[model samples]
Target: MKRLLALTLALLPTLATAGQITLILSDKIETSDGKICLYENAVKSEQVKVTASAQCRHTMTFED
Candidate 1:
């Protein structure tokens, strides 16, 4: 998680001037009770939602 965050931070400067940048990170995990949990970043695009599982998603949008 730290690495992911670091990577995202590292890329921010480059992407800042690149118009709009959308970063999506997702992960699926099973809880202690054996329940499948989905985590994802909130996105309004149906296309993204349909293509990506919400099993731990982190979405970050940046615009220049």
Candidate 2:
């Protein structure tokens, strides 16, 4: 178990940033509109309520 734990620990960071994800927030925002918010490896929430035009973009890269 020790070796497995060590291996997992060593690879945790690499695995964490192994992929790229993009989030595109629309320019049109409204209480009835829905937006995507990502947290960690998956979406934290959906159908965000907003009241105005908003645009956002996010990108992440991994390096050894």
Candidate 3:
């Protein structure tokens, strides 16, 4: 429960930079390293909703 809260808190800041969100569920615990790819959704939403995956292009890498 605490981990979920922490993750939520961490992701909230990302929303400030953009409208939608990407809930990256990784195999490894650490989210601050390479081997991870970040992408923006091609189709955006008009109404309020949540999605799992998006038609994305290979965007920039995440840096620590």
Candidate 4:
């Protein structure tokens, strides 16, 4: 299937640049200001940056 092979080759770049972020509830702790906050699992990715905590009860995935 030449067409299928061509299609797959055309999509290779998109797939290579695409990425996902996974956040999982790690802990609940108090801040210095006496406020409660949620902490999520640490994410290490050069393409994604997490600036805030996650308040989800389950795992979450975000694609871009």
lDDT of each candidate versus the true structure = 0.50, 0.45, 0.40, 0.52
| 38-60 per-residue lDDT for model 4 (tens digits) | 43455532222232353334454
Q: Which scores higher on lDDT, 3 or 4? A: 4
| Model 2, span 1-64: residue lDDT tens | 9999999999999787766443333333334564443323355222333333543334322232
Sorted on lDDT, highest at the top, how do the candidates line up?
A: 4, 1, 2, 3
Per-residue error for 2 in candidate 1, Å, reads: 0.3
By summed lDDT, which 10 consecutive residues of candidate 2 come out lowest?
55-64
TM-score of 2: 0.31
Model 4, residue 31: displacement in angstroms? Answer: 9.7
What ranges in model 3 sit over 4 Å off? 19-64
The C-alpha stretches of model 2 lying farther than 4 A from their native spots are: 21-64
| Cα lDDT of model 3 by residue, 1-64, tens digit | 9999999999987866664344333222223332333333453222222233432233332222
- Which pairs of residues collide in candidate 2? none
Return the top candidate by TM-score.
4
Which regions in candidate 4 have their CA more than 4 angstroms from the true location? Answer: 1-17, 29-39, 42-55
How does each model score on TM-score?
0.28, 0.31, 0.28, 0.32
Native-referenced Cα lDDT, model 2 = 0.45
